[model samples]
Structures are given as structure tokens and as C-alpha cells.
Target: MAEKNYYDILGVKKDASDADIKKRYRKLVRQFHPDVSDDPDADNKIAEINNAYETIRDKDKRAEYDAMLDNPFASQGGAGGFGGQSAGGQSGFRWEDMKDQFGDGEAFGGGGFRFDDIFSAFGRGARGSAGAQSSGTSGGFDQFGGGFGAQDSKGQDQHAEISVDLASVYSGDDYSIKLNVPVRKPNGSVDYENKTLKIKIPKGITDGKQIRLAGQGAAGHGGGKNGDLFLKVKITHSDNIRLEGADVYQTLNIAPWEAALGDKVNVTTPTGTLGVSIPKNSKSGSNLRLKGKGIPAKHTGDLYLTLNIVNPEVNTDEAKQAYEQLKQAFADTSIHR
Candidate 1:
């Protein structure tokens, strides 16, 4: 197969800036990510994007790739590549065919042949001599004739969920969040590492929304580009308030006397405590709306106060007398029955 151009794969110019490369990479990732895309080649496309982004995102690796693109035969692991036989060697052996003949043919005890093992089989002196030629020159081919390009420094971007309190969502504050991201090495092994980041919570941010942080993810390989961090916001229930869209709701308890007569009572809102007027003859379960006092947004919503009437203790002589007087006043009324 022919080598692919990293810049073309990422839809960027050869001289594209790091930020431009990242933007294009993210757009492609979203389109080709396996979890979201059902394209037959989505996985392959993602890998290609990752590889290309890794190569071009770094100055050194990109320069090396550009050099290799100018001259394909400049890399180590010779021109025929990967599974071909070395020229002028005895036994008419191909690396893949040799792997089939010997159970230990693969690199590092696998069925495949390792480049280093192939070099060792040819003798260390021969390998050293090959390296000496390729080491100093910009386009000199190595023993394997494959490119010895630098890896990407910025690793793959990872996604995770972050939990935020309702207060934080309502008030819009900065929160410290910790996440465990998976790091994969070039050899295909994976490990988890913990990272703490401070994220700014935007006001009126709904649950299940996603926030993106650039270059705050895993380290890249071979000096490639670093990955991005995605934070999915989740809000827990609050004790004082209930969230409904951009609106907030709470219940306020009022004394029987206060409910019957008009009064100004202190009510708590998400922003602060404020006094609200209850009209005379205000019945239990009355809802009072405090305008523009709810969650912060371009245009604020109202805070609702549902009134719950509470009866005073009748243990006191004055309270008992007042109740008796009220009862006597309604003695002729059949409404109680």
C-alpha cells in the first residue's frame, strides 16, 4: 500500500498551524468516532486521523515526515518493507515465511518478525554500520528502509463524565474535577492515570451538556500532539431549590395569621434572600413568582414560592382563647359541618 499524506488526511495545509490541525482533527474525530458514527470504515478513519494528527502536530515529527514524503526510501527498515526478504542473503528467506517456519519468528516472541531481531540475525556489526549511515543524513535509509519518524507528543483525546452540584449550575462557579483517563502506549498496552482540572461552570448549564478543554488530556507519543478532555456535566438534586429548565422553585411556610392578613415575608432565592409581599386573603398553596430572580442566563427566569400555611400551637391560654373566640363567632355557621 502507498503511504498516506498526513496533511491531506487531516484536511489541513502542509503549513497548517497547531491550532488549525487540532480543530480539523476534532471535527473528523466527531464524525468518525466509533461510538457515534456507523460508517463501515469509521474505525479505520479514526485511526488514520489519529495517526496523521499525531505526525503533523509536532514540529520535529512533521519535519521528519515531510522529509520522508520528499523521499520515500529515506526511512529505516528497507524499501520492500515489513515482510520482505533481505537481498543477497542465503536460504532464500522472507521474514513472514521464516515466521511460519520457526514458531519464534515474530518480533518479541510472536509469529511476526521484529525489525531488531532481523538486524540481530544479520549481525550487530552490520546493524551498527547501517545505523551509522542513516543517523547523520536527513534522507538516508536505515537497515529496515522504513522511516524512523518521531511519534506524536500530544496523545489521543479521551472522554469522561463530571458531576457538578445544582448550586454550581445555578450560580456559575469554577469547580475542580478529577478524572481517570486511559493512556495507551505504542506497543498496545493501556494504563489509567488521574488528572485534576479546574473547569468553569457556565450559568444555566443543563444536565448532560458537554464542555471541552483543549490539550488537557493524555500525552502524545513520538512527540505527537496531546489529546483533548471532554467533560459531561451532571447535576445532583439540591435541598433548597428544584430546577426546571432555567427556572428554580421552592416552598415557603407561612403562619395562619400571616396567610390570612397581608404581610411581607423573607424568602430565599438562588441569588439571595429577599422579602416578598403576600396579598390579604392569600390562601394555602398559593404560588408567588419572584421575577428575574432565578438561574442566571441571558434572560433570567422567575423563582416560585409555594405557600404552606402552618397553625400556631394552641397550648398557650391566649392562643386557646383566640381559637375559642373564633369558634364562637362561627357557631351559627353551618360551613364547618
Candidate 2:
């Protein structure tokens, strides 16, 4: 079988811009994300897409991979050409094949051979005798092609989005999300563990704010500290209401008579229920601002009630007669004029 092309996987051209690649990756993620996608192969597709994006998105990695594609045996010396045979005398050796054979370096033992080891090996010059070419103090491929990192490093941070209810933002609440989190086993192999995390939604947290959970991301390698998980908040509100920062706007329907004659009516808002007085001869689309009733925060926001006049159906004789009287009483009032 032929090797899969990263560009083909992401559906982008070789010369695609960074923004274009990002947009394509996001689109593919939305299509294959396990939570929302109905595709049976969503999990595998997502993994493949991630691997492709991770490789090509980086300059060094992309250049290294391009070298492999252009000429698998371009590099001279002990490391070989990454094809046919490697410095370790392994035939048909390649990073992707090795990843399939030993996942997360678990096959060899804990902290054995990781997928990232490929980058550490091929992305840089081969270390000469006496470790002359080694760049970092700890982590890199040794002269003998052994993958080792003397120093433990912190894991990469992970990001996700969470939908927060507007009401919950008004009054703090708890939320839960199930994630296929990566777990580092004793054997050094990484596997996904299905776990639920409880998140505390702080009051007055605006949209696009982030909540950080420590030690919730990928496990650190070689006993390094685990990375933090960041959750971007997305405030969700009902169709009748629109939220803008700390301010809340809601549509309040009122009877035509109440709008014209002015009256006190009870209204249910995000904060609570209150009796609001309608000014005499109120018109549709007029706003009634309630002081400091918006989302609760350090700087409180105001809630605006937009009036919408609704006419009653004149089905009964009494109602029809009332409408007839109202029409006659307002007959002289030319609304268009």
C-alpha cells in the first residue's frame, strides 16, 4: 500500500497558506469529531487528520517530511535514508511504520521509543562520535540511534470549548464533560481513558473566557509534570434573549391596550421576576432599561426589555364590539400621516 499524503489528508495544496491549512483542519475536525459526527470511522479519521496537521503545521517537521518525500535516501551516513534500511540495520524502516508497530513507545518499555522520537532523530543532524552533534542537554537521538531524554519535560497543554448557559453565568453553577483523555501506563505506552471532569462556572464569566484545570491534559513523559487543560467558554442563551458582554436584551410581549394605556406587569428575567411599569403610549421596539439587572459581574450590566405589542383576536361578540369602539375612537388618528 502507498503511504498517505499529509496534504491529501488535510485537503490542502502543498503551497497552502497557514490560515488556509488551519481553516481546512478545523473543518475536518468538525466533520469527524467523535461527539458530533455520525461516521463510524470518525475516531480513526480524527487521529489521522491530527497527525497530518501536527506534522505539516511545523516548519522543521514539514521540511524533514518533505525531504523524505523528495528522496527517502537523501541523507548520507549512519542514519541511512529512512527507507530500505536504517542506521539500526532495520529494513524498510520509517517513522510511520514504527508508530504502527510500537505505539507511544510502549512496546519497548516505559520511556522507550515515542512517535516524537522520529522528529528528534530526522529533524536534526546525526550526532557524531562523542555526541558532538547533540543539541539539547538531555533529549535527542544518541550516536547509536537510541532515543533518550535525560531531563523530564512538561507535557503539552490542551484546549477545548465548553458551552455555558447564560443563567449559569448569572449565578455560578457546576458543569460536567466527558473526554477521552490520554493516560500514561506503567509500561510507558499512552492510551485514552474515558473520564468525566466537573467544571465550576464562575458567576459573571463572559463569553470567550477560559477556565483552566491543572494536570488535566496529556501526561508528561519521563516523570515530567502534566499539562493544564483550558476550556473556552461559550455563553448560550434562549432565542428570545440576546447577550452582549455583560448586558442582556430580552423581548417582552405586551397587549396593545397595555402598551397604549400603560400598566404594571410582572416580567421574568434572567436575574429574577419583577413588576415593570410600561409608559403610556409605548410603541413597539421601545426599550425599557432595568438598572444593574444584566449579568452579574464586577461591573454589573443592565437588562433591556424591548416592547412588542400583540393584538388580541376579536373572535367573540364582546371582543368584536370592543374593537369596533376602539377603531371608532381612533378613527381620527391617521397613523401613516
Candidate 3:
């Protein structure tokens, strides 16, 4: 196959900024990743892009490539020629003679250049003396000497979802949670290990919020810092109560007589059951507000009770006869409706 231009593959200019290069790289990688793409040649294209990027992204390699473009044999023969063969393969030159001519110094007065040093820097292989093959094989950026300090004993971070009842968020408390954390051995092998961690749920924590646990993530290599654990909180619905903002709400079923004639009724709250007085002639759907009776927070919210009128189920003959008598008494009264 013909050599491909890295800049063309990435759709970037030769003089593109690092940021632009990275942006283009991410876009192309996402598009051509074999696992995520159905394109028949995606894998081959991705590999080509990788190689192209490796050559152009490096300052030294880019300069060398540019020089080669200017003079195909510049490094091989003319103008301070290094006795090395041009990648074009005209003929091999004496590398030692070029080294002597250039002197054992950093590239152009910068860091002194050593062929072995450059190879090692780029993660090719450990430097060997002249004529010795470097032992390490190249593996993309992972081979770069100063990349990640060590391999992760555990491959990747694990995630989990945690459900909290609405009441718990309203009135914060300590919770004990169990999680399966990936543990790695010294040899960089991983296994799922169950761990119990106690977390404090802050008062007024909202639903769908997240909590981070430091150093509770997957194990790192060579005793490196562990990854972080993220806990996503979901509020569960309750049968007895509904939550709105910071307030608690519930429907109170009351007998028709109790609603019409003022009466004391029992209502349940997070704290405890309390007696509530209903006004006389109260209508169904009338809301009663209890101040500071809702969530336990720094600024407490109120609880609301919506009254619901309920009629007793009459199944006996006597109950039916009494209902008939009541209907007859109110037969002419439009107020009953």
C-alpha cells in the first residue's frame, strides 16, 4: 500500500495546533474504531492513522519528515549528512561518521542526542549499544517511557447505582452500603471483592445527585493511587407520601360526618403520628398545612394534608334503611349535592 499522509487522514493542516490535532484524532478514532464501526476497512484505516499520527505528532520526527520532503537524501548525503540511509533506501551510510561530525550533543544544542536514548524515549526498546537490538516492542503511546507510571492491577473502574428512599434524603442519616470493588494482585491481575463502606447522607440531598468516594475505586498498579468510586442517588417513591420540593404531602381519608362536623384526626409524619383538628363544614379536597412538620432540615418545610371524603360501606339491612331515611330527609335540599 502507498504511504498515507497523517494530516490528510486526520483532516487537519500540517501546521495544526496540538488541540486541533487531538480533536481530529478523537473524531477519526471514534468513527473508525472496529468494535463500533461496520466499515470493512476501519481496522486497517485506524492502524494507518495511528502510525501517521505517531510520526507527525513528534517534533523530531516531524522535522525529519519535513527535511526528507525538502531533500529526499538530505540526511543521507548532502548538507551535514548523517551517514544513515534515507528511508527511501538509496544506500546505507556510516552512522558513526555522522555522529562524530555532529558531536555527542543534544539535538542542535538542546538535549544531547543519543540514538539509544531517542529509541528508549519513544518506548521502542531499552537502548542497546551499537548493533544490539532493543528488547521492547512498540505498542502505541502506551510504550512511551513517561506515560502512566504503572499498569492498573484492575483493568477499569466499576460503576453501581444506589437507590435511596425520599424520606432518607429529607432527613439525612448514616447509611451502610456494600459494593463490589475490583481488587488487583501485585502481578496486575484483578478480582471482584466485596467491600462495606459507611457513607454519611447529608440532609437535603436531592435526587439524582452524586457522591464521590475517594480511593475506593479499582486498584492501581505498583501501589499507585486507587481510582474513585461514584455513587449516583435515586429517590424511590413511597406509597404513603409524595415529595414536592422540600415539602411532604398526603391525602387523609375522613368520614363525611367527621369532615362536616369538626373533629380531631390522627396524621402520620416522619417524626411521629400527631393529632390534627379539622374545621367544621370542611369540604373535600381542602388542604390543611402543618408548619415545620415536613423534612428535618435547617430550614424546615411544611406538610400538607388534602382531605378526602369517604362514605361508610353499607352492607347490612339496617345500614341500608338508615341511608334511605337520610336520603328522604335531604330529598328537597339542594345543599347536599
| The 10-residue segment with the lowest total lDDT in model 1 | 79-88
Which parts of model 1 have CA positions greater than 4 angstroms off? 1-159, 217-227, 315-318, 330-337
Q: Cα deviation of 172 in candidate 2 (Å)?
A: 1.1
RMSD of 2: 11.7
Q: Residues 161-224, candidate 2, lDDT per residue (tens digit)? A: 9999888998999999998887655433346789899999999998898999999987765456
Segments of candidate 2 deviating more than 4 angstroms: 1-153, 186-188
lDDT string, candidate 3, 1-337, tens digits: 1233456667788789878887887788788766578888775665555445545555665665555446532333321111111221233223344456666534756565665465455443322222112322112223433121122122234466788876677668788999878675443334467899999887776556678887888675443467678888776765657777667787888997898788998877664688999999999899999988776556677888988899989999998998999899779978644
User: TM-score for each prediction?
Assistant: 0.50, 0.60, 0.53
Model 1: residue 172 alpha-carbon error in angstroms = 2.5
Q: Considering only N, C-alpha and C atoms within 3 Å, which residue pairs clash in candidate 3?
A: 83-93, 105-112, 106-111, 106-112
Lowest lDDT block of 10, candidate 3: 79-88
lDDT of 1 at 103: 51
Better of 2 and 3 by lDDT: 2
Candidate 1 per-residue lDDT over residues 1-337, each given as its tens digit = 1143567677888778899899998899788776678897765676667666666675775776666455533333221211112221232223444445555434555646676565565433443232323233211233333334333235767688888877677788898877776565554223467877888999888767788898777766534456788888877765646777667778888987788788998876666779889888888787888887776666677788888888888998998999999889779978633
Ranking by TM-score: 2, 3, 1
Q: Predictions ranked by lDDT, top down?
A: 2, 1, 3
